[model samples]
Target: MINIPFNKPYLTGKELFYIEDAVKKGKISGNGYYTQLCQKYFESKYGFNKCLLTTSCTDALEMAAILIDIKEGDEVIMPSYTFVSTANAFVLRGAKIVFADSRLDHPGIDEDQLESLITSKTKAIVPVHYAGVACDMDKIMNLANQYGLYVIEDAAQAIDSFYTGKDGIKKALGSIGHLAAFSFHETKNIISGEGGMLAINDRKFAERAEIIWEKGTNRSAFFRGEVDKYGWVDIGSSFLPSEIIAAFLWAQLENLEDIQQVRIAHWENYHQKLQEWTSDNLIQLPVIPSYATNNGHMFYLICKNLKQRTTIIDNLKSEGILSVFHYISLHRSQFYKGKNFNTVLKQTDIFSDCLLRLPMYYELKVEDVIYKITEK
Candidate 1:
């Protein structure tokens, strides 16, 4: 009898209402009323050069890969301790993935080691803002500028997250990178069942992003009366989401601040209460770097080792509480093992085995979760 599950999709009570509105509006397909509303909100709020809602973060990333012209033998750098889509998006375009290790104190890519991974073939750097915690974007951006490479922020888990640079300019995670992808999947801070958006911070990608988003056509311009006829003008796909998804997301977005506050409170509760317990047990709580702002998208702990982590999970399960692990080292994955991706990333491997995510959601019982983890 599992009392606590790993995740529960949250509803804002307006999801179905907006979804129904989308259905009744007779424009439930891509780029309709709800889709424009959601995209405009992201742009206005975050200062994205342009925003295009997609069916999933994966599709947004794929569009990014296309926009950046990732070709065969072109190398893309990213952390190995990331979801496969981070790498797969480029791999599909025939770009070679050069995996980087995670930081010693955080699951984010080790910025210090990023320079070593770059080469003549390196075309782009994809930084995964794991757990909605912003990666050191200033460092990553500086590197990208130095190398004339594109910075595509894989901000799948990062919604309402920010980073403060040394200059004291606080920028939204997706807004800082040249191009960024965001998720509104059920497990994210925001929910739309399955949806994402591409934030084009570079104005250059704006025109083509819509073209690719509309399946290689200038249909968007045509719809705007910018063109007389729309036809296949470039290589692209149907990457945009339906108005139904956009409507559901719009409801969630309208209540984002409330949802964020509740989740952050739970995250703070977990961190504050587990401090002594984690220290005494040789476990490490999640580390929020000073430059990054917590979006409360996740609450995870790093146990001493694989054995300790497994034991904790098993014990939690026996107590009817649920905890889960995260990504494996993409460099060590079976699919890439035969692709000469034999890089040994020590920190990435450790996180793959030891990091454990606790139950976190809008309606989570913070006290119940705290008592179960601490009492055990």
Candidate 2:
């Protein structure tokens, strides 16, 4: 039996060296030498105005919620097909979730229906770039401007991806919105075991974002000798990760180009091999919009229906290959039902029951598993 796991974290072979370097530097706490290096790398490479290293994408999103001053009774609009952390971050701040529907063709939020869900109580529009594909940013941003709402991009799966707007300019996925979050989970394109970052594009949030990231204090400024002393100045939490996590992430960052190239090659191979099934109308492949570039974060198939998807999973398991379904529609979850969500989420439900993720990683050997899926 040849058992293949769904995801195996890729290492660049310098993780321990950098971690040891951090330990030798005598600063393993957050915002140390390695942390600064990781943060600066993203800012310099991607053109983000500011970057803050956090423990995880969830923590980064929570920091966004706090920086935006989400309050009780405020409404946050986002797709119902996203991860819980996207909504939970705001829910913790007492915001009412206004669940949106996924697009008919892709799993990203439907940009056309975004404005209809807005109201005076709407505080922000959180767009989760599902599978690292960019949502219709122009339309989303226009709506945000018209309604005077904040756009917090949940770019959890969008590292190294891009969005080209109507102006013929290419913007990094996490650099377009007012604030954005990125994940460095073991399953993501880059791995830091458990890490993430917050990108602040809007200048207004720059100073305050650092303050909130440092446990609501001026410790960052104090360390730079800009402030006399550090003290609690606002409502915030400890969101920064230690230098060890940052050091591991820096190692991965150094090899980002190589990692992206190999993963994208794997993505193309799957697409080419699966075209027959898709052409026969037996399954559907991922839809990449013209404005977005694939970061090869994940590759998934949409089965004809729930029953068909189940049989595919069973068949894959019989071959000793692991396949799995993606997110359950948050609107239809046990938790969301308790909140009295009644709007129909047709597309979201379809994706919930039918989307099946194949094994995809930096080192995936596509030829080894191509036979099983091809036969079915």
Candidate 3:
């Protein structure tokens, strides 16, 4: 039996070359040449006002929490069917997380149900673009505008993806919100081992975001001759990554188009091959909303129930094929249990109990994954 791992990080052959070049430049600290290179690449491609590369998506979120000044007693609305980092980021700043449910046809936050959750204490809306699919950003942004709330997009699995708005104008996922975060973790579409980025669309936060990324100092501007002297200016941490990580990320970005094309082809192949099998088995495949474009970050399925999902996983593992389940709703987490924000989430719970992820990676053998899952 051929063992197939769920994810195997891909390299473009230039990772080490760039790392060597970075070392030769003699600066391994953050905000160095390779760091700027990656940042500029994203800014140029996505048209973001500014971009800051962080050590992880969690760091980016924490920076956003600080940038937005999420104080004690403030409320933040986000889907419960997401990674804990999404909630933990705000929670660290003493913000009360107001969890929302997932959509019936999709695992994304149900945009239609958002308005009911807003209150005078609501400060921001953090929408996780689950599986690289865009949440209903138009509704999200409209709500933010109406309620005067900030929008922080968790684009951890959403690189090179797009969202077409009502105006028919397509925008990059990370560029839609007031602030957006992207991950380049080894498990994602891109890999920098452990890395992420924070894109600033709202200009007000651009200058301040850099401060937060540079360990709460004005060091970024001070080095650029913008400030006479830099010191502890505000609250922040060591969010920015070193030149080595940036070098590895730069290599990945250089081949982004090629990588995206290959992953998308694999994604489409899986979708087509398993369509009949999934329907017959009472399983639902991933759904890409009309407004979203497939970046091929992930391909998952909705099993009938928790038992069925577990059975499928065991069957796959027996055949040397690894398959796994996703998040178990934030509200149901061990840490957050009985924290008083229950507010039953039907759709979120359903997804939490049934979502299964098959092998999805740059070098994945889609046929192998399909054969095992569809085998009688």
Candidate 3 lDDT score at position 163: 95
Tens digits of per-residue lDDT, candidate 3, 1-376, equal 6489988999999999999999999999999999999999999998888999999999999999998999999999999999989999999999999999999999999999999999999999999999999999999999999999999999999999999999999999999889999898999988999999999999999999998898889999999999899999988899999999999999999999999999999999999999999999999989888999999988899999999999999999999988889898888877787686557899999998999998988888899889888885
Model 2 scores a C-alpha lDDT of 0.92
lDDT of each: 0.92, 0.92, 0.93
Weakest 10 consecutive residues of candidate 2 by summed lDDT: 367-376
* Model 3 spans > 4 angstroms off: none
lDDT string for model 1 (196-304, tens) is 9999999999999999999999999999999999999999999998999999999999999999999999999999989999999999999889999999999999998
- State the displacement of the C-alpha of residue 301, model 3, in Å, after optimal TM-score superposition: 0.9
Q: Please give each candidate's TM-score.
A: 0.99, 0.98, 0.98
- Candidate 2: residue pairs that collide: none
Q: What's the C-alpha lDDT at position 312 in model 2? A: 86
- What's each prediction's clash count? 0, 0, 0
Model 3 residue 53 distance off true place after TM-score fit, in angstroms:
0.3
Model 2 TM-score (2 dp): 0.98
